[model samples]
Target: MAVAKLLLLILGGVAQLYGQTPPNVRPPTEHLREQRGIERGLPFVKWCCFASGCFSRPPSSSHSRTLPHPHSLTISRTSSHLSSSPKPPRSPSLPPAFTIGILLCVFGGLIRAYCYRALGAHFTFELSIRPKQALVTHGVYGVIRHPSYTGAFGLGVGMILCVFDRRGVIMSLVASAVASGGGSDNDQAVVTATLTCVCVTLLCILYFGFTKRMNNEDAMLEKHFGEEWRAWAKRVPYWLVPGVY
Candidate 1:
């Protein structure tokens, strides 16, 4: 009888603990948006949409000859059915710490948006080979050749900033260092996640920091404008940081 009572008490405690778990611990997507604010939500959607399909579709046949507007690019033969593709699974609602983390991410995002607005037509997340595409050397680009990259790196750090108390920052820094340094890992799951995040962060930064994106854009420009791009390239000797590279 004593053993039976103890077992019942143990079960009761387990149930109580489960009940004590906060509903806010895992709220809805709308709730997360509410926390991050509407201004930041749009950019999050834009990046998510871009990652989902916007960047993957091939350009239209005439897209190389002439610059297609953002809307037109979406309706092209290669992209017409992109919306029909199966949607990716949604992430679980943000936890408490994640709410704070998203705010930090928003600050970084705003920094990039400011740079983008300053860049206007010069701002592109992908490599464009259009004739009208000019080498942007004004505003933020004038100060830091790859302000976009610095903003993005800041975003990566921000996403985890408020998520884990004291240990969170330490863990995030370790992860960043390990991933950036290309440290090896024995665990397949850990290795896969680390490498994926690192690769994506690097790619985003390289889009503005490295010459590869510029070179690809130049290839397109050379095909279209030829001498115009040659002259521009001469003026912009380095792809990223002006003095360093």
Candidate 2:
């Protein structure tokens, strides 16, 4: 029994020594082997083995410096560090032109709403055959037959106000003149001077031509509403510009 107890104690001591390493133990050489395996993109744990074919125990921490291969951790760190910056936010600066545009938009919206309300059931913003549609003489239509178009023209002026500077404003005015056949832009300011002359000439011509056609429209209305249209015509003779007819 004494011999058996001694044998048991010896076996226990040997088992303990083999199972647990010393507290001050250095990193195993297997770490180098593991690192090498990682450098070649191989599994460190699978390749880890003792010379006598015994498999090594895993490191205590997964994040330990003892990788299966030497440089596997390095490659991971580098790849992670090389990521690009994410997308940036947009600027909040409002340009002068944009500001004016917003105001013009608001004015246009208000005008449209007023016209719609004034016209009520007879109102149609589009060119549709509302043959029975009565002439709108109240609100905006009392002065201008096409108040919406007048508002649109005013809105154009409002848009020009949004220009960043006086140069922008002048350029815009010149562009408008060109569009209206008021004048062309020469290299000199002569074009701007001529713009007014051309615009006035064009306006007189349009007034005679277009206004005559519109007056003829009153004849058609006269045929429909007869004396009623005549009375309205006398009250609001001018179509676009108010009080000048």
Top-TM-score structure, candidate number: 2
Per-residue lDDT of 41-126 in model 1, one digit per residue for the tens? Answer: 32343344223221111222222121223344446756646668756744332233434434445554555666666756545444
**Lowest-lDDT window of 10 residues in candidate 1?**
55-64
lDDT (0-100) at residue 128 of candidate 1?
36
TM-score of 1: 0.34
How many pairs of residues in model 1 come into backbone collision? Answer: 0
Assess each prediction's global lDDT (C-alpha) against the native: 0.43, 0.42
Which pairs of residues collide in candidate 1?
Answer: none
- How far is each candidate from the true structure, as Cα RMSD in Å? 25.4, 39.5
